[model samples]
Structure formats: structure tokens, C-alpha cells
Target: MKATILLFASARETVGAPSLTVELDENSTVGGLRSALARACPALIPLLPFLRIAIDSEYARNDQQIIPHDAELAVIPPVSGGSSLEIPAPP
Candidate 1:
């Protein structure tokens, strides 16, 4: 299966690309994608723990199945803000 992965903020910089196209096995899980990413981009290995993944624009869990033919996938790192709150502040 094939999917497009989008990187955000530091993840974009670390992976050295804004997005990439990848092929995976059918019914691949989010965790499987992370392993594939680490193989494709060594820089992503250490940071995987801090990253968040999305499937079709929604947050995804490690066990989540990737619908490569039906959805877009993204591997995003935690975004930082100047504010003290750990969660994203309202715009």
C-alpha cells in the first residue's frame, strides 16, 4: 500500500523533507509506519517516541490500522509554543 506522510515543525526539519511517499504492507499499523520511517530516515529513530501520527487528518494510535488506499498519513512531532501550557492554546 502507498501513503503520503506529512511532517510538521521540527519533524519537517529533522526528516529533511516536508512530505514523502511510502509503500507499506497491507494493514500496517501506526507503529509499523514508525519503524518504516526510522529505516527511511535515521534521524526519526530517536524522536519516534515524541512524535504523533495521523491518519486522514485525525490523530492515530500505535495500534491503529493504516488504510493506505483510502487515507493520508502523517508523522508529526510535538509542536512547541512560547506559552507555558503543554497543550495547544486556542487561536
Candidate 2:
């Protein structure tokens, strides 16, 4: 089975594409997908660890989560943007 995973943000930038396709076993699970992706695209290995995978528009709760055939898959980029706190320096 092959999965065309949608990419976003840094993941998209790294792959130079909005999506990537990888071959997987018939009973591929979320964890298996990760492994296959890494093997298919080594450049994504660094970001793969932090990126969240959504199956059928829902986030996979755990690595063991199963992925059914023809299911929608996406590599959700890590979130950014939080106001930094500033502390006053004492004289």
C-alpha cells in the first residue's frame, strides 16, 4: 500500500512539496508509516519526530494507532508563535 501524506510548514519546505508518497505494508500502523517515511525521505527524519500525523483529519493518539487504506493522512507541522515574556533587570 502507498500513502500520499500531506505536508505542512517546515515539513513542506523540507520536502519541497506539499505532499509525499511512501509505500507501506498492508497492515501499516502510524508507527510503521513514520518508519517508512523516514526511509523514503531521510531529510524529514529530523522533523518527523516532532511532526504530528493526522489520520482521516483526526490526530493519531499514539504511535500504535492503525491507518486504514485510503485514509487521509497529513503531517501537521509543529506550532509556532507565543509571546515571549520579558523580565526587568534589577539595577
Candidate 3:
């Protein structure tokens, strides 16, 4: 089976690509994909645990089965702070 993994943020930087295709067994799960990714990109091993995986736009559990042909897998790294605003003082 072949599936495409969409990389985001740190994952994209680490893999040096926006997306990648991987070959797996017919019974591959999310966990299996993780292992395959680690093998393909050693730099991603440290960040793998923190990544949130989504299949076809839905968050996937580690053991969730992956349907290579129909799944749109994405690897989302942890997000940090963004913009913030302060409350105005009472006059």
C-alpha cells in the first residue's frame, strides 16, 4: 500500500518536503506509519511522539488503521503561542 503524508511546521522542516509518499503493508496502522517515517527520516524520531496525526481530516489514534488509497494523512507538530492582546485599563 502507498500513502502520502502531509508535513507541517517542524515536520516539514525536518523532512525538507511538504509531503512524502510511503509504502506500507495492507494492514498498516498509524503506529506503523510512524515507524516507517522514523526509518525514512531519522531527524523526525524525536518529534514523532509530539506530532498529531490526522487521516482524512480527522484526528487519528496511534492504533487507527490507515487506508492507504483513501486516506489523506497529515503530520501536525505541536503549535506554540501566537498573537495576544492586553485588556485596556479602566479610565
On TM-score, the candidate that comes out on top is 3
Worst 10 residues of 2 by lDDT: 82-91
Write the residue-wise lDDT of candidate 1 on 5-85 in tens digits. 888776787767899767778988998888888877887676778789989889999998886567877776665555421
Regions of candidate 2 where Cα sits further than 4 Å from its true position: 81-91
lDDT of candidate 3 at residue 60, scale 0 to 100: 93
Please give me the total number of clashing residue pairs in predicted model 3: 0
lDDT of 3: 0.82
Cα-based lDDT at residue 2, candidate 1: 71
Ranking by lDDT: 3, 2, 1
Worst 10 residues of 1 by lDDT: 82-91
Winner on TM-score (1 vs 2): 2
Clashes (candidate 1): 0
Candidate 2 lDDT over 21-86, as tens digits, reads 999888778888889879988987877667788998888855555556878899876565452222
Strongest candidate by lDDT? 3
lDDT of 3 by residue, 1-91 (tens): 7778999888998889999888878999899999988988898888887788999998999998897568789997766556222222333
Candidate 2: RMSD over Cα atoms? 7.2
Number of clashing residue pairs in every model?
Answer: 0, 0, 0
